[model samples]
Target: MNWPQSFIKPKYLSLTYLLSLFLTLFFLSCEINYDGDERLLVTGRILNENNLPIPNQDVEFWIYKGSGAGGDDDLISLTATDNNGQFLMLIPSPNNEDGFELKISDPDTIYQHKILHRILDKNFTNYEYNIGDIVLYQHHVITNAYITFNKTTVNTSLMDVKFKGDADYLVWINEPETYYGDYEPTLAHDYYKNVPLNSTLTITYTIRDNSTETLSTHEATVTINNENLEYIINY
Candidate 1:
């Protein structure tokens, strides 16, 4: 008198349909990153250049405003490393923010603050994300070395002055070459570079004499320290 269970499939088909719907929604959510409720459990360890754990190191999570935002970065969360130099953060992924930055500050202020940025596309679906280990270095005390290029002759010549030093070595042209009215690189590219304490720099100048149509090279080496801050090169 009753319809067979196989023939009456509405109840069974509805259950299957609901299950499929749930799975589809779950995957769809994962595909769309930066969901409102999405969050990350971040973990990392802080160490010094000497391979020693840095305890009490500040850890700040920030939602970096992309270029042209014209606003300050939004702070997400702030914490510090434990005694063992380990840190963990439960931070949210904002739907509006396009980038994230982690600021690791040294509590003692000896080391320069580290900025970790350019992290945007990540698996927000994952329960945890580990940033691994970070190393901090103490701020290097730098001494500025001023340079002056003295031309030996008023005749026009091709002079190329080059310098080699650490990354901090910089050449800042505060005054344009028009100040000296010379087209030579010695006057045009003449600038000072910051030399860290106990750092050395090599200064080389290549001169192309227009009168003789020949080239001459000269080299000089100098070390910068607390006692020796001035490095003057003459051409």
Candidate 2:
């Protein structure tokens, strides 16, 4: 004997199926919602105290424990600040409570001084951060070196040069070889090392500009192995 279809199916089974389908579609069409609260989105522009946008800055947000989600470990990572110092990021789920960190640095010398700090905010877009201008301090040389050589040996020593500026810098030294006892250009845009006795050697050092897209140049000359060589730089 076969069971009747109506007897096998619950009276409200069809209605239940339709209701579930409707709910799923509705939720999918709408924005995120949980625990009776709607999702929140925030964004904003980053600017320095000088009113210029701090390009290439890093911006990140984290969770706040007291606000509900526990702490930083539960935080989400966001994108870096754009060339215009603008950024966008999603808020956390559940409590949606969070904080953020802003970091700005020099592209050239990552080791140079930097600005970093944490900001406590529930809404990032609603807030405007006025980070001050990132001023890079100049480097100063504490000591200078001048190397000379004689037959059978090389001379190493320091020279006292008065630099009339407040700066921190790196010094590079080079020894060029020449055919005569006087420093001269033996190669175009190139210099050689090591020379025989009676050949002149030109030793020079120059300071370099420690910045992005720029370089500092200086040169000096000295006699070595009876040759004088010309170099475009000395430190």
Candidate 3:
């Protein structure tokens, strides 16, 4: 006669034991964050006068000085506006017993705007303000617009270039309107994928708007093997 299966229990509660271990760990972790109030954080948002979100605008806060330390030029914390012109910034309490101030800056401007100035109370946190729609004025002058290459060479090869400008424009080969073709969005962010490298290479630029033409063209000639390669017409 065979002993019944239940007559002898398994030496180990393998499955049951493993499950209990896992559950214990999970419950322990839950106890840590169970309060849900530990994350008590100070938060705020920024909006335009029209109650619109201003994206990419920088906001800063600084410590205040009552002794006419107005020229204390250092930023404690900075937060940028989001696409909706809204910002959620976090500010830590000051280490010393000093006053505090707040300032906002427009990314497009040469210098940022000083939005607010005041002394901070001991109980300072969770600040909010509606800066309104900030007018982004043009700061880049087109007169100095042009392409720059690493080095003009005699070898017939292509080289990548870093193009920096205010807008996504085109680089013409010869005159503003003349070129191999219009190459753009040109390296996306301040970079060109492939640029031609020749002994005598000349390049110009054209604005996005075809109606307005460039005032002048900028050209760079490559010195290959200590020889000059001229491509211009002879009189």
Candidate whose lDDT is highest: 1
Report the C-alpha lDDT of model 3 over 1-235, residue by residue, as the tens digit.
8877656655355688778888887554332121322221223454433355557778665554323422233355678877765555545444332444555677766422444444445234344333334432222311122233332222222222223221222322123222233433332212222222222233333223223432333333332222222322110
The whole-model lDDT of each prediction reads: 0.64, 0.38, 0.39
In candidate 1, which residue pairs get closer than 3 Å at backbone N, Cα or C atoms, i.e. clash?
A: none
TM-scores vs. true structure, each candidate = 0.45, 0.28, 0.31
lDDT of 1 by residue, 169-211 (tens): 1112122233332345444444565555576778777666676
Model 3, position 85, has a per-residue lDDT of 58
Which pairs clash (backbone N, Cα, C closer than 3 Å) in model 3?
48-132, 49-132, 53-84, 53-85, 54-85, 55-82, 64-99, 64-100, 187-191
Backbone collision count in every prediction?
0, 25, 9
Model 3 regions more than 4 Å off? 1-43, 66-74, 110-114, 122-235
